[model samples]
Target: MSLGAAPAPGVLEERYARLPAHQREKLNRIADTRRRLDAAARGAYEALREAQDDLRRARAALREAEEHTTRRTGGTLSLRQPDGRVMEFPARPWPPPELAQRVQRLEADVARLHAEHAAASAPAGVTTRLYERLLEHLGLRDLA
Candidate 1:
């Protein structure tokens, strides 16, 4: 059996095509910006994950180094961290400088990427709402 005819163009596409060129341009710009923001959010999320993994490795290394230091010193290693958690690192010998720095850097990177991802993803939703409102205002809500 043959289907009678091809379906008509999408109602939304037809309605969108009827919009004035300037209005179409505006919508396209908003769409492009939303795409860019979404891409950035994804990139930032991946970066954050990598940074967190690096931080985890750095922390483990630091712990091992501290344990060794404690063993060598023949004393307990305990220090209160800025977050109020007591980190047991031989009080006598500090963490290897490079390991401590790497951990700090990774922590900062994770925090920054978290903020960036939030910022980038947030505007995508805002643009979507604005696009819907524009469509509604233009009497295209039903088509949308």
Candidate 2:
């Protein structure tokens, strides 16, 4: 029963068999809950990573656009009229305002994803701790 000692073969199975039906059911329920929490946490973590990648791409695009705009003249296209008259058509910046707006939106999305990741991670951690404690309480810490 000591921490350094290993249980004999089939000991775990024997102990589990000796558990009361209600207690076994409760353990199963806790295990199922832990699995669900872990799944949710993984999903949230993936989403967070994806959001961060999207934010990075958005930022890079915005930086490139800004750089292009700064290195170029005002957005204007000129054409020579049929009568030899020069006409200029005014236009927006090289990178439209929408790109900047997209950057802003992506930043917000990254923040939201971070929050969601933390929310999901916290529950998974708590569940793991709870399960560990349950195993210890059942004298099955080795199973952890």
Best by lDDT: 2
For model 1, residues 72-121, the per-residue Cα lDDT tens digits are: 33466655554656655444536667777888989998899889889888
Q: Which parts of model 1 have CA positions greater than 4 angstroms off?
A: 1-9, 68-70, 74-92, 142-144
For model 2, residues 24-53, the per-residue Cα lDDT tens digits are 787788889888888988998898898889
- C-alpha lDDT values of all predictions: 0.74, 0.77
Worst 10 residues of 2 by lDDT: 64-73
State in Å the error of residue 38, model 2. 0.8
lDDT of 2: 0.77
Alpha-carbon lDDT of model 1: 0.74
